[model samples]
Target chain A: GGIITQTPKFLIGQEGQKLTLKCQQNFNHDTMYWYRQDSGKGLRLIYYSITENDLQKGDLSEGYDASREKKSSFSLTVTSAQKNEMAVFLCASSIWDNYAEQFFGPGTRLTVL
Target chain B: GDQVEQSPSALSLHEGTSSALRCNFTTTTRSVQWFRQNSRGSLINLFYLASGTKENGRLKSAFDSKELYSTLHIRDAQLEDSGTYFCAAGNNAGAKLTFGGGTRLTVRP
Candidate 1:
């Protein structure tokens, strides 16, 4: 019954700029994830964290960096925004070892100018 | 080839009508999850099934572990049912879930 909150619902940045997105979950879940979704497409996992200060790279982790500073927060940074990379970034969390279900946050839309 | 494929990339139906969306996996899947992405970009988890079927209100979902497919049936659809539906599947021992291209549903009034 907890919520995941992502800041800056909308973000506009220039190509090559480094943009950071923040996510916070109060669900006390042990696993957190970051995913990207193109318009009319499925979600792609970018990065995930198993616990505090732990990070794992996903299929699309290149050009992206993630950090779990605390158990409650996970952050994703676009190393160099690509003009064609405008998409929504979604944050999700799940209980440890519960890969079956993950709760998602209201996504953050990013547009590279 | 896609590890996961969702059929009827888009669908439109009148309110009170019914329709079903399907997801086919390339290999056996241990679990499947269904989600609805609202227009405002919030994803709501609809169902998570390891096997068999589950129902909540007007939505029913079933996962076929052996057939590598899953189905979501919406009955007596309502206007609020309009959204992008997605299915994600994971193998028996993996934590990663391969996602299928979503199905866009528009329930007309």
Candidate 2:
């Protein structure tokens, strides 16, 4: 079985700082996704990539930028972090099928001070 | 707007008890997926159903595309099952998934 790995299990950033989170998958999946989860809320999609160098915005992509430089890796950048913001960012990968299940990595917890 | 709504935002169950979680979609969806998020914030995929029912271990999940709803049943719950459970729906032939608010399950011994 393949695994999805996310870097920096915890992150602490100052206001207006730009923080980047990285994800890597060994599943050789064709689709990768970025999602944000706040306390007491559901996961909201930020961005997704169908292939290398392809990007698509999601419902919550206004303050985030994503890059898929290679097929096995996807990265998300938080542009100008909001003060007192606390959330967990998750990375997931799935095969290119309508019924394929998306596997997720252990999230990166972001805390802005 | 296409949405997924989950019932019983929070639930508490004693070990060995059984319960069910429900997800209702605002529109017709192609498929549904269930995930369990552990305390450390890792999401583990449980089930992905296009239709009918699927069972794995002590968990059983059913999806009715015609009714725009899904259900997840846990039998003889264990303490290790304490976590947040979420259901996501896919409307089209893409990778986008709309997630429900999640049901927080606390299984106490």
Candidate 3:
């Protein structure tokens, strides 16, 4: 039973400011994902990494950048925050298999002013 | 475009009642996963099904790849079950999960 940990439970950023969120997983999984959740909506995938230093863009990756410097950690950077933007960013990890279930972290709530 | 559609965007149930959530995929999917997001924004995985059904405690989930759909049944619902529920469908390969809009469940005592 491993856990996924995300840093900074809450974040407040100004428009055009850059912010970064970090995630770590102890599951030793080969895949990590970043997703964005808006109020009253489902999650949209931003980026995913299959292995260390490997990155793949998802449906919503245009405004974000992701880095997988190590196998156990994945990070996301918001290039330029949008004014009045509010969303929760979630990090998840899964094994390499096709049927593996993803384990998610608590999430980081981002609010842009 | 391949998409996942979930029904009953919101639901209100009294404690002890039972209800089900459903997800339909536009294309055939290899598997389906169910997750519940708590009030504090933590997603708890409930089930992952490649085919047939899997049961855990009071929750049971079923996935039918041929039918391109899945269902989640909650029996004797409790107040703690109140949260947003999401279903994601994965392609035949690794981790191409597309999520549904989610159902907001409010279980009142």
The candidate maximizing lDDT is 2
Least accurate 10 contiguous residues by lDDT in model 1 chain A: A94-103
TM-score of chain B as predicted in candidate 2: 0.96
lDDT of 1 by residue, A1-113 (tens): 99999998999999999999999999999899999998889998899998998899988999999999999999999999998668999999988774547889998999998
DockQ of each: 0.68, 0.75, 0.72
lDDT of 3 by residue, A10-54 (tens): 999999998999999999999999999999888888999988999
Q: What is the TM-score of each candidate against the true structure?
A: 0.96, 0.97, 0.96
Model 3 / residue A43 / CA error / Å = 0.7
Q: Clashes in model 2: which pairs?
A: none
Segments of candidate 2 deviating more than 4 angstroms: none
User: Taking the tens digit of each residue's C-alpha lDDT, what string does model 2 give over A20-82?
Assistant: 999999999999999999997889889999889899999899999999989999999999999
Q: Candidate 1 — which pairs collide? A: none
TM-score of 1: 0.96
Q: What is the DockQ of candidate 2?
A: 0.75
Tens digit of per-residue lDDT, candidate 1, span B37-84: 988989899999999999999999999888889999999999999999
